[model samples]
Target chain A: MTNLTLALDAMGGDHGPHITVPATLQALRLSSFLHIILVGNEAEITPYLSQIETSVRSRIEILHTTEVVSMSDRPVHALRNRKQSSMRLAIELVRDGKADACLSAGNTGALMAMSKVLLKTLPGIDRPALVSCLPAVNKTPVYLLDLGANVSCCSETLFQFAVMGSVLCEAVDKNPSPKVALLNVGIEEIKGNDQVQQAGQLLQQSPQLNYVGFIEGNDLFSGNVDVIVCDGFVGNITLKTSEGIARLLVHQLEKGLQQGFFVRLMAKLIAPRINSVLNQMNPDHYNGASLIGLRGIVVKSHGSADESAYLQAINLAVTEAQRRLPQMIEERLESILLDINS
Target chain B: MTNLTLALDAMGGDHGPHITVPATLQALRLSSFLHIILVGNEAEITPYLSQIETSVRSRIEILHTTEVVSMSDRPVHALRNRKQSSMRLAIELVRDGKADACLSAGNTGALMAMSKVLLKTLPGIDRPALVSCLPAVNKTPVYLLDLGANVSCCSETLFQFAVMGSVLCEAVDKNPSPKVALLNVGIEEIKGNDQVQQAGQLLQQSPQLNYVGFIEGNDLFSGNVDVIVCDGFVGNITLKTSEGIARLLVHQLEKGLQQGFFVRLMAKLIAPRINSVLNQMNPDHYNGASLIGLRGIVVKSHGSADESAYLQAINLAVTEAQRRLPQMIEERLESILLDINS
Candidate 1:
């Protein structure tokens, strides 16, 4: 009976419909006002329908699409050839206003390509950015923009990305005055290269952003700034490196503790504290990065994402939909681009 | 009495004499074949002399220099104006054959400028690279070159750097057939722009280098390779960023442990393990990056270095002096530059 419909690309991710169906059911249970639109082959979805309760069945609906896009498939080719891809169909649901947002764990490039091709950029958006949440000091998540969304970037693009990132932090993070920083080599303003230096000056001069000065990678988890801006290439490397190291630390901890009984006892005593630390750093709790500056909603998930990650993605879309995030981005960014154009 | 003499710049770091003097003494104690050359104001050196025992005093010498280069002073300006800076004095000692190699905790730019102007480059050396060791998986260090020795770099420079870095690793890390990787955005030989791709081909075809493959920032710690080669801009950024993050993580851990009873208990139990982890990650433990291809030897510390850090620097210089590392680099890299020119 409610109008908040979310389109899910059920055929995507490692778990596919096997985990997708139940996760979708679990998400729908959280909101009585929620509606679910599943995008994939109807034949594949049909076999799993009997598993869900009759009440949950009414809240879920299917939109049939025949083609599947494998993770390794070329993005441009897949978009050009497969009009019936579940990812495309899911995005179409948002474009046509049948669903509020599309959440996909499909091939990231294809999702981005299709979203750009189908939904188009929001008015005044130079480029759409991928925004993700990172663990900050107090267990709160700060938004980092262009997280592998684009590799090569210009000063103008980064300047604009900063404005868009600030808008999202305000819209979603709810910090009325979101502190913004450009990632740099050092704390000293002049230490970064020409591009970062120029962007720093622009952000500082602009009334649109708080322009919290430069932040090194260390400051990302320090909670000193609410939003961190960088081109996608640097952003991608930072994100993956931190994740890899954190996982490596956890692995080392587990292995090191298992070597002796005394070490194991010590681990057991400290298990809760370690759990708290790990939970504070968990990516799942934060869930879903918004594709900022997109006209309509599209959330990309890790290609190897599981049911828990998809559920997080679904929640992210619903939150953004209810909050009307992109519309706010478009409005906030209008003056900045107009000034540049003029 | 040992003929081996190392010229330590006493007035270099943010902390200056405090860190410098102690580190010199520590180095002298650890290494039997070392004569410490303390370069700074005689007034400053005479006071620290009281701390050294009479027997050790016989091995220590001071080259009186009045002026120290402040961090704010420009590189070329410091080199021209501060005629008595420890960095300049140290380099002079090496050139005059009074010392084997120069070690400093001074301004990096000033040291680079002074070393290039005075010590000059080895024959066929296009550019001298600052190469240092970073953590690899097995708790051993890998050599990463051009770590702020040059800001702007070309394909030929990087190709030459790989050869220099391989020899430096062999001499210092003792890793024969050290796997050299060109740092890039991706592993694809064609992933980066033309310069990186061209260098990739040259490195792969290089018989002198192990030439393992392309490496990203994440791969630096993986121990998959022993020598990482990149432009100075990227290398400098990577080194600083890693150091900044390690410091930030320690701060976070301290806060998490010392604040409450649960945290204190957790800290007490894991204190030994954390110390081991941190000791393995300390910048001081892997201190002293080499300015390779210089006509003589020069080593620069992190600008904010302390006494322990300076001692690490002195220890590194003694190692380089004993190995006669500069002679090895000069002999090894002569033909690599020829290949580039041809």
Candidate 2:
């Protein structure tokens, strides 16, 4: 908790201000040194701000804009048309050094598009990737990257993703020299496609990286690796598939728990613990996915995220901003590239 | 069980005859008319066969093969050498019309290669794909295909998978005109890569096939469609990822259930119900995957499957054999291709 000011897209996400406004107030209350600038339509966002007390309200600032990026809007359209949109303005604040970070629960493609253009990618990085932490068995979260930023990636792009993922993991998790792994169909050398195989070669040659060999999808939560990298197509599907499984299991278990009178009654007694377990299993609970490799911090919340999940996104932004993640990545990449060249 | 004989590669999986033999006996007990030809080393196979009673023992036969395919062996290696391997011989039984179907829990690559070469793909089909039923919210399972059979599939290859998946789903699940979908990163038209988009176009044009549009990974268990198709790479990762999540949730819940005395006592009271729910969630319990598009039936069990899981695989092979899946696919594809050509 270092003192920092962050920008929030209050007009983004499914519920927009309904979820983001409350989450913003909650964040301000929790962090005494933190300040947030809410970007959205003035009339829609002002009502949520009215309930806050004067002392706490002093830390909140609202930058009014009329336009908003809908979920269905194409990335290219959003970039060209929506200059005053809440999502765009939030990232612009970070780009202009008016805020330390940008957090948005908006169209993922649009958010990435705006963030990359405005905040710009860090030097030596070709593109920014979406990185998210997934719950793992060993109490620590596993960082998975390129969650649908670039659908199909080349070998060099995948290599860049690994470098960004490793830097972000080390900076945020406070684990130096974090073990990185490439996600593939099998653990064997000849398992994945050409892109994955070529990337593996690049990683293996980099002595600067703690590059473990291949990891399959089943080991996503095995807690044996710190960072797992793949192209966006596979990564997106893997993340979403895990979410679907979580929902299915929870729904099935709850249905089964309601069967007999005694079992139902017993279920009530352990409802709290069961709910906690379900929450941990739910990927929605881990809401923030950083658009890494950009010059400034940008955290993307799930489009359907509720107030609590939105709050987690804000907290993630705070953490990343405080740690100066972009700077660390810049320094790390510079040295790694130099070493490879030598 | 319509008095069908299945060739079993008893020496294939991690446990070899130890798990497969007990599973075969269990399958025999469940289906009185079903007979199994256990193909493996005579010395190792005879010991398990000796313990069975006289009446049930009549249903079992041993086909000795000393060479067994190791899990690490490549597909080309197994196809070139290891001709007398249990996996190869089991598939040969189906090719020679000695058995109705072939089932193995052996090295997947070897099994597919051997099955494709010996049994051969259907007339219009270029290759065989691995199709497995995944647990959905509805009682009926969803069929997902191309599970690591061909790593990176082309548009035409993906189209073939959809046709094969539809045929198998209709025959095995007994649902006529099953809703077929292509698995993609998004449901939108502009979402996936070239192969997926082109496949979508082909599926849309096929009026004979019940081709529903795209499905995202989160909808895998939604039970909205009967058949979901993807390349081997994505399908394999999705299947294994869900399995990993199931284990994580079950482990987390069990750990939670063991906490307090009162809650622990109640957990024991409902332990049976809880176990049943966990079993349904676990993918291994739904253990059989069909190697479809071949001229003969072939079912694949998990490599580390236990007795119960392996038994499910045997049951699956029996069902496919009884339904004459390959014949159904051949007839269906003939008419569909004729319709498309016209």
Candidate 3:
């Protein structure tokens, strides 16, 4: 495979350069054909870069910037004043064809706004959605889109999300024909608001897409469908709620183990097996959420991501870059629009 | 406490009388002042009743009904054709003042339809909402409403839900001036749809309610707020998704335990502790969901609830009945409406 270059937002997330620099180096070690352009203030990033080995240092370069976008900065404010910020500069690299993709763990709203204004949406796409893969019982991850991009979506926008999500699974996950379902309260035809119901109708009519009708939040991890589509409002809530429940379970299990001597001894014996399962279910295991539907690739890592989790985000950028995901989505969307117009 | 009579739809749920009968008897054993009028096919219910001890037989009565509401029956169809159905008869008893409260594990749509038509909504309520309590990490249960009643809700409807939910926690859960919050994609004022944003504004302006602004889905189980309000569409999806995640965690943990001989042995040793923790997190532990905003009390159990879970539903009904929940909601709503108008 040819080397894919990524623009790393070094001054992003909570720990910024401290987390991003090591994660970038670790990702470079894993993939021989990978390069990154670290974009951040030189003073903050240089100290971390100096720790890298001399041989690997050639594969990395720093694009110094003066401004930083704090977590609390508003998207509009960031766009107007922080044009030279690390987050914007990294996305600018993608727009300039200097990088295969860009990755950030910065303010999600600002990152999305900067990416959209700089790279622009692809043809036939209404809005770019935050797409992420959630692990399912079937051991194959299900792709969920519009995590928190567009809070209020029209029927046409949701229909577009389903198409984009399907393309994502097909391109990155390598599913030949991904099964897509609209997330609703119930599976019945008469369920949900007009936006969701109308979207389901449009999906069913599309011959190119494998539309599986409606699915509830409970069906998210059941792994029955490859792509689950919903507006950002419902998608964001569902994703966060799932993470909360997972944490509750682990907390309860640990509390249970601390009850008695026999239980503690037994828990110690099976600790390895239990830890493996917990790690798999950990939200960190699936940290990166792609900002799909844009002309250029932009993957958003969690703001609180550690080095390992940040590396997972880099891996996502690498995989999507290698597969030429944005180009594939553009092609699929054009054919879909042609099919609809015909 | 004065004896509270409960009209139970024994024919409701998948297992019908098999689960409801034993659950009723168990509930009777726990509460000396509790009385149940079983509404279902006499033949099926009589067999289970005959097993009850002669001493407690006086507390139980059979109100035989020939018709039944199947899970697949449409709400409109059930209301038109099945007036004499077990589900309807149980609700009718509440309307006729023969029972203090009614409980049904039947078709959710049918139960809501019949209850609304029979009991009617409270004077100021626009619509009746399905309210249920969810277990939180703090070991306190948070009351959530509109679980699947009003699919599309206006800001006023959601504002009413907050009022009704607060009254519920106060009356049944004994939370004085419960902290109420609107469930949204994010806690920020600028986030979420117009309806949620408008509802938040309304909530903040109201002095009668302890409105705590917006909360995300992750906060549902965080135990930070006493009442979480949202439209039925979002609420139902969030509730079901939490149940699904809890189930997935248990399934994965068990699978991990079965990996090797040593692990299996260790799992066996810690089985009791694990089971205790799982039971607490089980949906069964929190099975009862009350239909709030109505003039009369109506509780809906899970359609697949077993005897133990059904008992939880019965417990909810008894508690609400003893506390005079309907009366409390009516009074609180009146004062709030007066506050608004003033």
Residue range A156-249, candidate 2, lDDT tens digits: 9999999999988889888888999999999999688899999999999899999998999899998999999998888999999988888888
Winner by lDDT between candidate 2 and candidate 1: 2
Q: What is the lDDT of residue A137 in candidate 3?
A: 43
Per-residue lDDT of candidate 3, residues A85-178 (tens digit): 9999999999999999999999998998998899999998879999987744457988888999888899999999999999998887789999
Evaluated with DockQ, which candidate comes out highest?
Answer: 3
Give per-model TM-scores: 0.90, 0.96, 0.96
The C-alpha stretches of model 1 lying farther than 4 A from their native spots are: A43-47, A282-287, A338-342, B121-127, B135-137, B145-154, B188-195, B216-219, B254-270, B282-286, B335-342
Candidate 1 local lDDT, residue B252: 60
Which of the two, 1 or 2, has more TM-score? 2
lDDT for B124 in candidate 1 is 65
**lDDT for model 2, on a 0 to 1 scale?**
0.90
Worst 10 residues of 3 chain B by lDDT: B132-141
B101: Cα error in model 3, Å = 0.9
How well does candidate 3 score on lDDT at residue A24? 87
Residue clash pairs of candidate 2? none
lDDT of each: 0.76, 0.90, 0.89
Lowest summed lDDT over 10 consecutive residues: which window, candidate 2 chain A?
A132-141
Question: What DockQ values do the models have?
Answer: 0.36, 0.73, 0.75
DockQ of prediction 3:
0.75
